[model samples]
Target: MNVIPYNYSPEAIRLGILHIGVGNFHRAHQQFYINRLLEDSDQQHWGVCGVCLLPSDKNVVENLRSQNLEYTLTVCGRHGGDEVYQIGSLRELIWGVEQPEMVIQKIAEDTIKIITLTITEGGYNINKETNEFDFEDEKIKHDLHYKDQPITVFGFLAAGLRKRRAGNCSGITILSCDNLQHNGDTAKKAFISFIQAQDKDLAEWAEAHVTFPNSMVDRITPATTAENIAKLNELSGANDKAPVHCEDFCQWVIEDHFIGGRPALERVGVAFTADVTTYENMKLSLLNASHTLLSYPAFLKGYRKVDEAMRDDDICRYIRDFMDIDISPYVPPPAGIDLEKYKQTLLERFANRSISDQVSRLCADGISKFPVYIVPNLAKMIKDRKDLTRLAFLIAAYRHYLKYQLDEQGQAYDILEPAKSVEDEQLIESDSAADFLNLSAFKSLNLKTAETFVPVYLNFVNAIKDKGISETLKLLTA
Candidate 1:
């Protein structure tokens, strides 16, 4: 039960990467890669400086700092074994709320070549309907007015890049590790827009010197609960507080477009390519969209974990059919990727018991997820005149889950969503599927008017209303 030792001295590591949003996924995926890279070579300069923006992240910063910015990463394999490694890739942890000036200074440092982000899907603040930066957002407005004391990630990035420009530090790459489509491009747009509103000169400087490389990052790092921490401590025989546990499977496809030199990430299983769109599309459509498709139905049926839902034959079949019949047609096989095997692999990943990914995690932020994961394929299916009954059922399930915040066992849960308009709530309450489809959430595709979509969606909605989610799923799979 001894923990794996670190290769390099923690004091010797240099911070070349400044990572925003020091969440579980960032620790497990990106930092894990840096740890691997550091172990193999003299890449001590590529160490990460973790940055936590929100006040809620204060505890994480304190935990990492108390541990000398070192923690155990327990990687669980599907074959029923765990590998524990003490990750020292994080050289320092910065709490942005406590020291905003230090966060800016860190970004402006010449040694910091790349800045990565794992801010959740909503962190971009793109209007779901417009797919553009929501300048009218109160946070954006506040960040613009009070640039010196910023709160959001956008403000931090803008202020940091401005400092870098003033210092004449070399250009740097902003790598987005979020799951959104064209994530790098999205970050570019959002950051540039934020800067433009604050200072036209900084925006121009960012446009010239800053590079946002889109990346497709994959890993199932669940939120670390106290139970997980206890188990990790027991397994690793260490009293680490912020240990991260994730499935052993990991993949990072990044665009090789860094302005400043990047780590030898390719040496440690990172895929650097000219284009990451195909890979991004494949993962988002098959894996992410399937997560969304299964989550609401599974949760409504009282299944709390993804693997538990995957064990149900009806739910499994529905997801398989949804992928093969509806989504696969839209997702072209990426180079060197076999679509069928990839789809099967996705099923296995979802079924990985070691990860124990929560259904609620997948269910959170559906409003943001749908546009990136579900909508584009859905739009294509409608355009191709294909049967969307299964997809329609997914939408129906999502609506039902939202309207009734109670699961099948009568346990009530809060729906974590942005403020819903009265009209949106009325639509959810309305029995008409068409009314629900007309929601601005679905306005991107005008899904309500898709001739074949409306009737099937309405039928499923009515059936779910009459029968429960479990019964409806059984009928659909049968």
Candidate 2:
């Protein structure tokens, strides 16, 4: 297989976008698009400066720096051969954990027109109930006192914006390229709230200058395993340390309210819309929510690979019914979208063996995920007095997975719940089936008060424990 390297000069490209999280999703999606855009001489200044905020980012950052920030991206399709590309859009790198001052300075630089983020859903430090910044956070408190030497992303944003104010630099856009629904607005609420608590003047400056545009991004990017790296190096014939692989499909719909201008992204298949509400709701409710719906039960049933999970007739049927019967009514089709076809395409994408998205990736961070992906639609369903057996079963399975730490086959597995607090552990571990409903993920729905929802949920919870997950799912799907 021939590896198609970027056509343009890498050194000539300068940084215009300071992307906060240099993760696989960013590499596979946004950076891939920018790499394409950089092929044109006029877009040379639009290259990305990847910022690493966490200590976990050290290895990837070191690898990219070794290669002068150039890496490979393998695009796997549902039914076609892989297209290998040596992407060069990531022109610079900065690890904020090591150099917090530099992170602030770069954001203050007028040359950097936009600050894009791939910080996962829970990274916002939002109080789930209030949907605002959690000021009581110790790190946030530290940032408030020591604004100049910042640590958190919000701290970096505030300090940087303040520096920009002092330097009289033009305002920049803060676009969230994450999976969170209404992500831009959420970001605005968090940043503004934090900045307001720390400095009134800086908060006002950001309020006037900053624009957070809502965006809907799609791509099935799996975590690159050691086997993937070995195979990628074999196929591309490159000793690339920071190589990334994702499904061929990618979509980024922006609210088109960019400050200090934006790249000609539309020319590169990016959609610019006055409103991203419909797209956000549709994608969140259908793809993201369905991913959550299937993850626990599928994992509990001992399926790790999404493709393998989808191969099961009952699993596929469950997901299909979820999209059509549970979610379709609320998700109005965005322009040019055939809802039914999109749902079919999603199934096909999930079933793509080449990509093989991990069921565990879907299973990770369910504490944060449930609130974002599942609860909204679940709340609506409860309000409408609709059939919620599937949703209830998902909760039951999640409880079983978390509390037991064992699959239906009695195989012990590690669960990844990044947002799991001590209190969350207590609730999940509580013997009472009804106590799990009070988990922060479902707090907004107030499931205890949900007359139609609780009885069914508790039934599944009790039945799954008594009869086992396999038998219970067989009954649910029947």
Candidate 3:
């Protein structure tokens, strides 16, 4: 028997954007939008030059190269329905850790107008206290010492911008697709702090010339599994080397701020607006908050899959109540979005049985994720004097998961725990449930707000212990 892999010829397009942290979401949302521009218009100069931040990304790089940097995306559904989309928008691929100079050189090029990042929430090594670059972080220190090596993303950006300035290249957009509040602003602050710490004049020049666009991106993309690989081959009839499978929903809303150049993304399903805060708040507060709620409880209940837990009536009802009660009031919807309808659509999407998004996947990086996704709503609910029973339950779930204990049945599982530093990458796991809340982490929280949360959080801990996980679920849901 003979087998042939699909071949996609690279178009003669100049790289106008360099995307760092090119993960599944980047492929599904950003690259998908670029693909639309490629097919509809003649301006092919905006093709993406992909940059993988981590050394482990070599697997994806090799797979992409095998298929000439092209892959398929399937927006799968609960039933037997699915939508297939494909595009060759990644014209070039560069592994940052392997070829650090290439990343800097490409970014310094006059043709590259944008440098987008999907480096995840925790990837940016910022000091939580100062909200600035963590100079003490080994990676940051190494990057600063070996400034020529361009080891870290911030280092690469700073070095490239300095080069562009020396050469008088046009200013480029720095877009962040991470789930941080005011993500673009955070990226800008990090860049500014790092640059200023090193050189004052360059920092001022970057401040005056560059553009940082904040965006809200949504899609439920689980880690690639054997099943996912098999599904890609079965559904698409091509052995996709780096296939990205997701639920049948996707959304990208951006502030229409760009420097030098941009793709006609509006031709696709992207929304470009003046104020993306409302959209950002809605997605983070409701969608992400609810996800944080379900993640731990589902894992504690021994349901590994997101779609499976969504099928549980107990879980589904709690999810709905979480959105309508705890999360909805805090989230001001973007223009033209019906909050209720949107919630309904999200519930449907979450319940899509075919997509096996994992609970552990959602639970990762809670130290960073909760601060943005859950903390704001928690703070707002306290301000409004709303009942925190639902929010408290989420905290309780975190506490229970931190125990990292199997149920009475002796099944084993894992939950993410924070470390003392980035170098101490191991999770600080323990059987003590209270250790999970880490009240010290919330000490900087407003005095009045923090005091109120203490009692409710304590009450939740009692409920989780006095009653079992299922009973706590019933109490919260009822």
Q: Which 10 consecutive residues of model 2 have the lowest summed lDDT?
A: 127-136
Top model by lDDT, which number? 2
Candidate scoring better on lDDT of 1 and 3: 1
The residue ranges of model 2 lying beyond 4 angstroms of the native Cα positions read none
lDDT of 3: 0.78
Off by over 4 Å in 1: 419-423
Give per-residue lDDT, candidate 3, residue 203.
Answer: 91
lDDT of 2 by residue, 1-478 (tens): 8889889987799899999999999999999899999988998999898899899999999999999988999899799798899898888899998888889899999999999999999999998877767888899999999988788898899989999999999989999988898999998998899999999988888888999999999999999988889988898898999889999889999999988999999889999999999999999999999899889988988899999999988888888989999999999999899999999999999999888889999999999999999999898999899999899999988998899998888789998998888888999989887888999888888898889988898999889889987788778888
Clashes (backbone N, CA, C under 3 Å), per candidate, total 0, 0, 0
The lDDT per prediction is 0.88, 0.91, 0.78
Residues 1-478, candidate 3, lDDT per residue (tens digit)?
Answer: 1222223335556678899988888887888778767665455787899998687898998889888888888767757577667758898899987788888888899999988999888666766555667788777877677767767888888888888999999988999998888889888888888888777888999988899988889888888887788877787787777788888788999899997868888877889988789999988887887888888888877788888999888999999988887777777787788999999988887888777788889888666777778777676777787887777777776756655466524587655655334322222253444344453233244423456666777677777777767888877777
Stretches > 4 Å off in candidate 3? 1-9, 407-409, 417-436, 439-441, 446-451
Per-candidate TM equals 0.97, 0.99, 0.92
Task: Pick the winner on lDDT between candidates 2 and 3.
Answer: 2
Model 1: how far residue 59 lies from native, Å: 1.8
